[model samples]
Target: MIVRGKDITGPLRESADVCIIGSGCGGGASAKILAEAGKKVILLEEGGYFTSRDFDGTEGFAYQTMYQRRAGQSTEDLSVTVLQGRCVGGSTTVNWMTSLRTPEFTLDDWRHRFGIEGLSAKDLDPYFERVERYLNVKAEPDENHNPNNRIILDGARALGYSTKANGRNARGCVRSGACGLGCPFDAKLSVALTYVPDAVKSGATVYADCRAEKIEGSGKTKRVAGYVLDNERRTTKTDFVIEAPVVIVSASAIHSPVLLLKSGVCNSSRQLGKNLTFHLTTAVAGRFERIIYPSGGIPQSAMCDEFLNKNGDNGGFWVEAVPVYPALAALAFPGFGRAHRERMREFPHTGASITLVKEIDSVGRVTVNDHGRASISYDPGPKDIEYLKQGVAAAARIHFAAGAKEVMTLHARPTIIRSEGEIERKIRAASWERNSLALFSAHPLGTCRMGNDPQNSVVDPHCQTHDVPGLFVIDGSVTPTSLGVNPQITLLGIAEKSAEWLAENFAAVAR
Candidate 1:
């Protein structure tokens, strides 16, 4: 039922009730929900379907096979790192399986600031419950903790900071900190193993390795009409226009905006690619006298939300425990050649966690090139730099409290502090003036934000484009602001709710 490659040729040549793009968490979840409702669906993914056997537990090959723009190719300038998955399951296939719901505060902010109605926690609870049920979301019990996870717990307890087990979509995970490398044991519950399959079983057709070139349509009478697909070997046109009155764009925050621009829809607001927010993260590594293989446990078993509620004026930052693999650690280390190699050899004795700073009102743009590829332009704002410095100082303190022999900050200066007081002083003195730190983003939001007013937002509160009928964007592209947490679960919840709304309203709109 999960047709791929050659199997898509004939089916895509025909029409369906709805066509959804990008079979990631949002798309996959939407497909399953709509298909189960007995609607004909066709899901298109630009990448191939890769299983556990295809994952080699290495960074290079996985990047080539599963990642979009390749592993290291995509970046906004050389300083800001951007990573996105490009497989049939999209980023869900390669992402860490941590699942956290959008915070209530964020929902409230959307209601108050954007005038978005019916987005409160109470209204969304049902959708969250349904998503959690399908994902089998649960916290990591004590037995699941590994050295990497325990260190985080010990640090939090020692510092009088709060910590809680993180909810992840997994079962029988043996604590193998390889979630970033693609879960080899098939324990990680990604969409490839969940909704995508469910959609197939419910008779939805899936097409992989098919890159959608352009969405053909015009004005409020738009219908997507068809798409030009290229699979390297051949290029063809699928003019299968659906009689149904809906088209769902579930592409990620980055690509969805680019698609809209290419299609000449929602361009009036000019907000399709503005307001990009990346939960900017940096790591702190410490050396322990005892051997602690951080990679021997579940990748992310716990997190500290002690600062999650810090007032916006107070420069709030969110810190979470993260396991680092040797290769990734080396990339983050602030040294060259011999020093870096020596540090890499001590990977077994290193413990690290990343701190994500909720940035200020920083704005970025996503632009498509003549070749139809998406490129991002952004730089951290001044307030964001201050927040990063505060977060780095805090992360250093946590490691020192955990009985670290020495702590290393992931900055250009590479300050190594042995005592708690020195950690604070050195981190404070560290300069973020030049944007020298190795910065990366896992969550990208607000590219095509939603609001009640069409003048300020690309999409309406119901996720429909202001200038285009029969078009809806049901992914992170519609996030009005950063949720300051992993967005995969929240995106699924939104997609589920939006799909239901579309299903109920589609016939009325069609008439």
Candidate 2:
């Protein structure tokens, strides 16, 4: 059953076959799979359950209510960007709903570079199929097109850049473009609407607004006994200790590592919070002769994968059109005052797209503060900066090709370029420094990586902590490396496979 509100402070009974933490795409999917397999499951979420009616389409209140640490404003060295969702559905509720399985090349790299033997594209294909089936994943059909998607289609067609409708996990969407602010329509198939509800129907219990502080367990065997949680009232212990013999950490990439460290499990490797990767994104905008309402339909409808295959020093970015509201657009545009206000009035004529760089080498670390809050330390490497420059240049050219009267590039000093030549020079000469430019990332991966070795990786191939026998991590934290795309589907696929593996192996491990 799904329990909501702040009344989580009362006595709680928590004995279950599996206790999963953080009910997002991973945790929710795991709960569904395990409960359906007849395992007594209890899912704990730190944020309360919120429905589409609760979404007010405003940034401030939504961030405070739905996001972690209040929209993850915490910074690392005052430069790196960190964003994660805290509610029952996690980032899936706040994300753009674009879903893609891990690319074949990424899986190949995991096998070849990371030595993860069984994690081939073919091995994961069936799991991805299962995930797609559960989420009802499909490309945005032609009838769902809004003005923002039309603008992207027109621009890509004019520039001769190959673009296609992005597959997203949503149903009955009315083309209202309020994704970042939160979808008011019950169209987005977030985990809260899909897996969480299904899990509840299958006899899984969910406790919301209960924050897990630290995991308490014994040594030698290194099995998690149970966790101490702050229920926004007082510290309370579960009525029964979980003799279930299985603990899964499905928290996002940021919190999972911190929780592991706090629990003193998997310290043998000490690789808990390293090798963080985010798909760095930058936006570029243009004003058209006609109004192109940004707030209509899904935020991202099409993507340009033309530059994805460009290897070596030349190819590094994937550009996609992203619909942005006036408030956010104003925040991204350089400069303030009357010019910004005027641009706000011209919101109907404005269009924007983001260049997402698949950065791998640039590393970041997630560290827990004295109070146990998670903080990150990251700086983009030189290679990432180069890719951003190339991506900006390419995006500007596409806009101009679409017959844009002028193109506005988002940089420390915004520049309006009228021609393709100007766009090239501006991007080529632009500063790539972290502080010199603004960058945002919706995808965070590899804070707690999975591998076969205990000395180098935090989790084993099955996502179990090498030292902690019963503890498993099934979130993005177990991703060996960055997947260079929306990781919701990939995470869900992993969760499904991991849940089945855990259910089958729980008896053996319990002994």
Candidate 2 C-alpha lDDT tens digits along 1-511: 8876444444554567778889998899999988988888888887767888889888876777777766655456545456678788999888888888887778877777678876788888899898787777888877676666666677778878778888888788776776666678988889999999998899998877655656666322323333334434444444223334677888888888888778766768878888877777887887778776776667886788777646843226788878776556776776678876776787878778888888856777888888776788777777877777888888877777766778877666667787877877777776666656667777888888988888899888778788877788999988887777779988988888878888787777544
lDDT of 2: 0.76
TM-score of each: 0.93, 0.92
**Model 2: pairs clashing at backbone N, Cα or C within 3 Å:** 175-296, 175-297, 176-297, 177-296, 177-297
List the lowest-lDDT window of 10 residues for candidate 1.
219-228
Per-candidate Cα lDDT values, in order, are 0.77, 0.76
What tens-digit string does per-residue lDDT give for candidate 1 at 434-482? 3467787878778989999889998887788887776778888898887
